[model samples]
Target: MKDGQEYLLFLTPEQDGLFGTRGVTFGKVPLNTEELEVSEDQIESSHTHTEKLRTIFNEGRKKYGK
Candidate 1:
């Protein structure tokens, strides 16, 4: 996805959570674009991870206050 373009990302099982204003770099994975399928389920999952990240960061800020 292009920068400044809104996008939802579903992290793999290994990923902890979503990115707030920060960005992430994924490993290079070759795939067939023709078989790509994006669904509401994936979007929701991404949203969930984003929320989780937000919560975690909030808690950290509370603790550090810096």
Candidate 2:
């Protein structure tokens, strides 16, 4: 993700109870259309590893982006 940009992230805690943002690049999604920078584009363009997140993003956009 880029600095200062908002994202819809899927976070989970490790065995130590500390949250990990490690999959930001693979599962996280940008919150705004304007925030679809290179990384975000890359994410949408390739869904081999992120089909669920992509589906969520699409459903959200269709439902909320009126």
**What C-alpha lDDT values do all the predictions have?**
0.37, 0.58
lDDT of 1 at 54: 51
Candidates in order, TM-scores: namely: 0.32, 0.46
Q: State, as a TM-score between 0 and 1, how close model 2 is to the true structure.
A: 0.46
Q: Which portions of model 1 show Cα errors greater than 4 Å?
A: 1-45
C-alpha RMSD values across all candidates: 13.2, 5.2
Candidate 1 lDDT over residue span 1-66, tens digit each: 434433333344444664332324221111222112333453355767656545544454445333
Model 2 over residues 1-66: C-alpha lDDT tens digits?
668866665577878778775464534657666333335554566656466656666665565454
Best by lDDT: 2
Off by over 4 Å in 2: 22-26, 34-53, 60-66
Q: Candidate 1 overall Cα lDDT vs. reference?
A: 0.37
Measured by C-alpha RMSD in angstroms, how accurate is candidate 1?
A: 13.2
